[model samples]
Target: MSETATAEAAYYEHTLTHRPLDPVSRYTPHPGLAQITSKLLTLPAEIRARIYHHAFQGNRVAVTSVRGCYCGSVATGPYRDDLNWMLKLPRWGELSYEVRRAFIGEALWEIHCEKAFEAFVARFRYLSNGNDALLRQVRHIKVNVFEIIRESWLVETNVFGPALRSITFGPWQKGWTIDVPNAVESPDELSDEKLMVRVTHAINTKHGYGFLKEAWEKGRVQRGGWKALFLFPIRYHVKQKDGKKRWQMQTWRADLDEGVIEKDWKDVHLVQEATLD
Candidate 1:
């Protein structure tokens, strides 16, 4: 993508959306370093700034963890991955549509699971031609992945609903990708398992869902003396399923090392790692 276009779109999304830019490196870099140290030195400030700018340029939305839960399956439950389909949209318009449809299907799936303890979810279905007749019976859904630190995949979509063809849902097949400045968390800190749980609660509850949802509805980010960036509300569903329904928020399998390394909601234990290919 053109840097100019990226910057413009990013400016709109950041400034207009009041999305927070990732923090600058708190640790100052040495002005000059020996040849060997060069490899370890941070990128120049101007360059780093540009990199930060570009990282969140297009189709990049913030993610956070599930609220009020510890254990959820990482792969199937609530989690998120960067939308990698944006790059392909402008080139193959039809392909973009399909990707977006798939996205909606995934999102719808999450909505179903969030609203009820569903035993099964319909397959995220889409057609090569964006056919409404053929898609009449297909279901689409989405689950959000909330990013707290540098990491993502905390909240995820795991359910589906019937597909639609209007613009409201036309983009259903278009794909998505997230462009985060960096992985907020990394290297799995196992030494402080207890502390990690506390931290998780703080992020998932205090800053994750509550804030973003308001932001989306308000269409602007509110600033405050105590508030920081990347705070917003999360989407939740409270619908009927299998002729039975009750409110139960989805959970995630959080791993300190892998960052949602895996999830298993029924047990309510966010393990340290996930077992996925």
Candidate 2:
């Protein structure tokens, strides 16, 4: 776990709302809700685990990395209206509430991608009571990057860092493959990944997200023109060429703790992994 740039500062500004002294009073449990919770708790432990397992296992969710407080133009992309919105998780608060409610009902924490998890944590960090009760309940927030910029996701996870979880970067797209830049070659000196994963890892664990500014400044010279400066790190601007290239839709099942991420061909695949600088 590495410290954020803010950690270097003695203190923080733009403070978050603090929990009231009588924080217990904040939650007025509904009688109906309490009754239901009580009834569920009364069920056998094995039965309860099964119920939770059913809720999370293999559920397909649309993933989004919300770098901004609000989703703005890209408000979580597309989700199926079906499944009673079971796992679409369009809003950060909905997912956060879902996490807290599930944990309070029965200690189940379904894992999520790094971006989704950080989005949840970022949304609720200030009010976290002791034990990180909400965060602990988080297993993973499955991400479907949805043709988004690579830097967008990187900035998201860095906002929270290891204050979050394993991130399982890409069962969505081969964990972290989406963000790792294909343009650069790794010098012999440093060897995390030949691409952006290692750079992102360093910025996250060592220097903090601020490294993006420095990184972009260093590389902007190589970028083509003003348009590139406006979107310095977003590598995918125009869609692919060659009539053979077309979007290949993928289906997914949620893998539990195995943390499987598969490769989808992209810039990194253009060259052999062996020859990568």
Candidate 3:
């Protein structure tokens, strides 16, 4: 058959191997907890796939010319949360839209996404090993399930930038199993909280997360007092550039109001696809 079909079949075969058929019989064997978690994540995975399919299939401009690491149009519904978190990635920040798309590729990359889940599981295992004693006895960490939901859900946006030159779609390692250390206590230095903060800061600064200095500068000319009146929130603030500090966010509210951005601002971007439930 076609290469796409062959690839798709291989992907499914791999998934089945990881997640054995449920309701094990004499002929079937039970899978591990890690396998179970991997399957659970597939719910979101399928939802994300549909978004990509719709966008690429429709051949929408917003999907093709997006500025940042995101592919397809604005995500809607359940997929919004996943898209938001991706935008916040430090590696994504470093990548332009073209580079990001190349990394993700056009076809389904279940294996690549699986590797991310695997890494997350490994980290979770590390924490669980340390708190195993407390977790075994405790029933609940908090009361509000909604709060948990809110914390995990984040919104994302896609903006077009430079393209990537080379792409690697797999994890740093492949098919490696992590073993929790025998020590009863976990290292405080392995905290993910600090890792996330540092990653986010790096992305924001390195990728020009907040605003485009070049765009703002070009947008500010030939306006009388009108330009100054508009870009109030985005003043000529100093930001690091090329290992040295420089003026960024130079435009004001007035610059945006009657400034360089296309008149049909809404039409400039499009919502391509989304998933919520």
Among these predictions, the greatest TM-score belongs to 2
Alpha-carbon error at 7 in model 3, in Å?
A: 6.0
lDDT of each: 0.28, 0.31, 0.25
Question: Which of the numbered candidates is closest to the native, going by highest lDDT?
Answer: 2
- lDDT by residue (tens digit), candidate 1, 14-86: 3212222232323333345233233322556566334323432222221212332221223223322333323
What does candidate 2's lDDT look like per residue over 234-256, in tens digits? 22112256533233323222112
Please give the RMSD to the true structure for each candidate, in Å.
22.5, 17.6, 25.0
Tens-place lDDT per residue, model 3, 236-261, is: 22334555444332111112323232
Model 1 has an lDDT value of 0.28
Using lDDT as the yardstick, the better of models 1 and 2 is: 2
Q: Point out where model 2 deviates above 4 Å.
A: 1-39, 60-119, 142-166, 170-277
Off by over 4 Å in 3: 1-10, 13-169, 187-189, 192-277
Backbone clash total for model 1 is 65
TM-score leaderboard ranking = 2, 1, 3
Listed in order, each prediction's TM-score against the native is 0.19, 0.32, 0.16
